[model samples]
Target chain A: MTHTDNGFSATRRLILQGASAVVLVGLGNLPFGLAPAFAAANDKYPEEAFKAKSEADAIKALYGKTPEASDKVKMDAPEIAENGAVVPVSVTTTLPDVTSISFLVAENPVALVASYKIPAGTMPSVANRIKMAKTSNVIVVVEAGGKLYSATKEVKVTVGGCGG
Target chain B: MASTIRVRATSSGETTEVQALIQHPMDSGFVKDAKGEIIPPHFIQQLTFEYDGKPVFTADWGGGVSKDPYVKFAFKGGKKGDELKVSWTDNKGASDTTTAKIQ
Candidate 1:
């Protein structure tokens, strides 16, 4: 059928675009010729990654690879958070060609806190507020130059953030 | 309804800095209300910032993010008086978008 041929061509084009679009993530398996039209739409949400209950599973779901620990990935977090509901965390990486950064809480019910995509020309630093259920180690992962690096720190919470 | 997003974009010659604060409960579904019933998860799943029609920064968030989330980042090549677009879509499919002029 002619429609089959069109679908094949469209899929090929989508693959090519995915290869070039560093801003997009985890969207390669979307089917149908209509998928390419969505290239301009919002990026696909990683529902599975957010649902991972541990840090290691989350990192694998999001990036499909493991990251090496590195000192260059600097994480700024409070030694003790007065309010667990709004613990301010940030990261700045000295690594080159940084493409993405992610946060994970080793003790939270869902370990993955936040993940960010850094396009070309964007600075390699990001700051945000997150929640911690209790005292836990906060890990930051930086993806740079086709490789992944990470840093971690312990943050103590006086009170629980996920509703004690 | 008034938009729930508040954004400020400032360009300093070479780099542009953006800070945004969004009003949302960001409920992690792990909490209970006064009646002891569980609160279902309601959180923003994705937030994007676009300049010159290209995404400079994008955030994929989970319920672990704080309520009324605030985030900051910077990128190169944004010009003064230009426009930057900020938008977010929550898990329930609710979305809000707004544009801010660079200063």
Candidate 2:
């Protein structure tokens, strides 16, 4: 029993030392750990796309061109969002070659709420729950025939979701 | 490790509707924690839906989304027993994936 007691203390001390070493290593790599996370998040997409303050600018930054209002695209949203945090919005199009669909909440801090890439043979329709900072126009941009088209609808919200 | 996602997909009338509920804090980095410290940004940035091997629907999300994000979207072509894979990557470099079969 006496011999085993010494071994137990030795093992406990070793574990404590190992934990301290791990903590020191983690502190040493703090800068590297945090930098890659931010780089990865921003590197996946253009920084300007999300920072665009207006719907038009977001569309341009996202698609590299302005969109024209077209009747072929259908934008659907509630006349009033009961909950601004989860406003259901959808876009459908009858146009051929619908490549992508994007949603923008003009009143939010960041205008571009969502951008969807629709592959061929898949439906040209998408539904998503987006946050509306306030009462604003919900814009849907669709890319078809190598051109950009858009549709807009106003959604009134009583509660602001963007940090409100 | 990131949180889990529950996915369900059903096909009807030549269309498949996919719905997924992702468990996440969705910290906007604007909210403060118990100690008044700003919770660093940790939210799913992108989510992708794939059928078989092709990408059908993808979403670029931000931290403004509510907690425990729920998303639903539909696509044109899908059949019963077809596999639908949903994957997501967060700002913290954590990722999660789950799959369901069209019913």
Candidate 3:
């Protein structure tokens, strides 16, 4: 009886400790919780975008509208990426009120790789290291004033980033 | 735990360039472990860069990004000795922040 009681108390203590940790994390009580409510209203990550198999479908799911190629969107990527695992991709736009920016890899299993929200007054430029399964046309989309614009650049990958 | 986010900022001309590397597995659920079991997806979901408490850059990342992801960006109005703070939150609800002085 005593052994069973001790085990039960230990389990209860663990449960309490777990609950407190979660509460502290959620409340941003830790030093790393600077912006506790960073995206409370818009933290809804698009589940459909990352699961999309085709570029068009991913763009459709993300913006609910088709994107048109625009000269205002500038995408800078290597003509050939020596390493597919860390292809440097950057996008800049002259468009105003830029709301969102996304990168799509044509040949990856899933087209949408990364998407970012550009808050007001911040620059509409972003750079990230993205993985490509193979040589593919990288598409960048920028949303501004409720309209979608895009630019594409073909990057040749010598090595496959996704497992062979 | 010590902050795993490493940040460096340098000023050139009128813009301040910031580069950061975050230590993370960035496991994609599609990958299998050595035991052939699927590794659950865990990645940094959001990363924010602040200059003196004002947000200058923010990113929404997914698992497709490589492990120990690196990001580079620049803002127009940064000066020397200014504090550049970076904070990130992973899908598991864990967060970390680190600060660097602009050079």
Each model's iRMS: 0.8, 2.1, 2.1
Pairs of colliding residues, candidate 2: none
The list of candidate 1 runs beyond 4 A from truth reads A1-42
DockQ for model 3 equals 0.36
lDDT score, candidate 2, position A97: 95
TM-score of chain B of each: 0.98, 0.93, 0.95
Ranking of candidates on TM-score, top first:
1, 2, 3
lDDT of 2 by residue, B10-98 (tens): 99969888888888887766566678777787878888888977778777877666778887778887999989988899878889888
Clashes in model 1: which pairs?
A: none
Candidate 3 clash figure, as a count:
0
Model 3 steric clash pairs: none
Candidates 2 and 3 compared by lDDT, better number: 3
lDDT of 1 at B48: 93
Q: Relative to the unseen true structure, what is the C-alpha lDDT of residue A99 in candidate 1, on a scale of 0 to 100?
A: 87
Q: What tens-digit string does per-residue lDDT give for candidate 1 at B1-103? A: 9889999999999999999999999999999999999999999999999999888999999999999999999999999999999999999999999999999
RMSD, candidate 3, Å: 10.3
Q: Model 2: runs farther than 4 Å from truth? A: A1-44, B1-3, B30-39
lDDT of 1 by residue, A93-112 (tens): 88999989999999999999
Per residue, candidate 3 scores C-alpha lDDT tens digits across A36-84 of 5555545566777878989999999888999999999999999999888
Q: Which stretches of candidate 3 lie over 4 Å from their true place?
A: A1-39, B12-14, B33-37
Error of 2 at A130 (Å): 1.0
